[model samples]
Target chain A: SQTIHQWPATLVQPVGSPLSLECTVEGTSNPNLYWYRQAAGRGLQLLFYSVGIGQISSEVPQNLSASRPQDRQFILSSKKLLLSDSGFYLCASTGGHTEAFFGQGTRLTVV
Target chain B: GESVGLHLPTLSVQEGDNSIINCAYSNSASDYFIWYKQESGKGPQFIIDIRSNMDKRQGQRVTVLLNKTVKHLSLQIAATQPGDSAVYFCAADNQAGTALIFGKGTTLSVSS
Candidate 1:
């Protein structure tokens, strides 16, 4: 079975602080990875996706960035946090078109 | 200009009743559609999915219906329970190999 894991399930950061969120997948390799954010009562907003190591496609222009250091390890980072950056961040992996497995999201609160 | 949207923002149903949620997409190239359920403080969980070639697909107590002509999709939940209360989202896969485009969610509230 495939499983995804994300760290720092919840975080509160001050304005202008650096951010780092890590996602790792177990039981699968060479899978596509994605980073998404969901605002309250809104749809999910795709932030970044990685097909292979060192390759990342950002879906939106913002203070956030993503990197795939390994085949199953993805990282979402930011140099400075903005108040608008606060939301629930999710990490997902897809094996095929059936469905995507998601990790328990991280609730980020920027003050 | 491709976007996905839900017909209703929220739906309330009594426990043990069946629930239907609707969604619409504008992209004609979409080949796959999926429904997800996200509970409070949790990530979205896969409920069911239907391919373009097929109009209906079923899972454990959940079903997905796709209407390619109208570019619409729906999720049906039978015998809804309190645990089934969550935000439901539908995503359309353009087969672009990028990612699924998600629609604004519809909150399902199940009351006993």
Candidate 2:
């Protein structure tokens, strides 16, 4: 199936609020998953990626952290959101050296 | 630092014409490259890809050309249509070779 499920297609939270965005993949084992943030009218910024459970890499140091608790589940979290955290957040998974599959994405707004 | 950038932010073409979108990568070591098309409020979808070992690759109506020497890449669309209007981005494996990186993207407007 190779499907990715990302919830809360749109979110509005206040600054300093906790944030959690979840993504789960189906039909693949040990797939590489990624979290990307895209600002309005800008390119995608790779925030975090996980090759396997408990093996996460941070591409950019920010207010966000990612955890891969299960082989097919990846989570993006923020203890305290910042206004700058607002952006279009996407979850993706791929087989190495192949095209990555993406979820619908969550549009977050920090007010 | 590794970076992928586009030469133009916007490109316009008339229906039935051909369109070319260009990208440049900073890391010469990057071998895997791909092109993606993103519509408004939608996730980017894979269009085509080429490896550094090859100079060109083609899909249904799209072609990807890679120039390892110049560190350049381009996507050519044959017979552009208004339905093809979207933002096109180029991606390459980063220096770490663990994740793919993306460029700012070029908006291709195909007028009918």
Candidate 3:
């Protein structure tokens, strides 16, 4: 079975501070990874996706960026956080054919 | 631009009653669709999925109906329980299958 781990489960960051959220998948290789953000009472918005290491696609222009350092490791980062950057961030992976699996999301609050 | 949207933002049902949620998509090229359930403070969970080729699919207690002609989809939950209360979302895959575009969620509240 494959599992995705994301941390920290909850984060509180002051405005203009740097942000880093990590997601790692175990038991799968070369999986497609994605980052999505959900504002309160809103649907998820795809932020970024990666097909392979060092390959990332941005779905929307924003303050965040994503990186795939290894086959199973993906990171979401920001040089400076904005109040609008606060939301529940989710990490998901798919085998390219089946349904995607999601990790426990990270709740980020930028105050 | 193509997008997925739900017909309603909230739904209320009594226990043991059947629940139906509807969605619509604008992308004609979408070949795959999925339904997800998210409890409060938790990630969305895969509930069921249906391909564009099939009109309907069934899971343990849920059913997904796809109407490609109208570009519509629906999720049916039988014998609704309180545990079924959550926000449900519908998603469609692009022709390339590279990314899934999600619809605004419909919050379902099942009372016992």
TM-score, model 2 to reference: 0.98
Chain A vs native chain A, TM-score per candidate:
0.97, 0.98, 0.98
Which of the CAPRI classes, incorrect, acceptable, medium or high, describes model 3?
medium
For DockQ, the strongest prediction is: 3
- Can you tell me the CAPRI class of model 1? medium
How accurate locally, in lDDT, is each candidate? Answer: 0.91, 0.93, 0.94
TM-score of 3: 0.98
TM-score of each: 0.97, 0.98, 0.98
Clashing pairs in 2: none
So what's the TM-score on candidate 1? Answer: 0.97
What tens-digit string does per-residue lDDT give for candidate 3 at A1-111?
A: 679999999999999999999999998899999999999999989899999999999989999999999999999999999999999999999887568889999999999
Reference interface contacts recovered per candidate: 0.67, 0.59, 0.65
Candidate 2 per-residue lDDT, tens place, B65-101, comes to: 9999999999999999999999999999988777899
How do all the candidates rank in terms of DockQ, highest first?
3, 2, 1
Please give the distance, in angstroms, between residue A21's alpha carbon in candidate 3 and its true position after superposition.
0.4
Where model 3 places Cα greater than 4 Å from the true spot, the runs are none
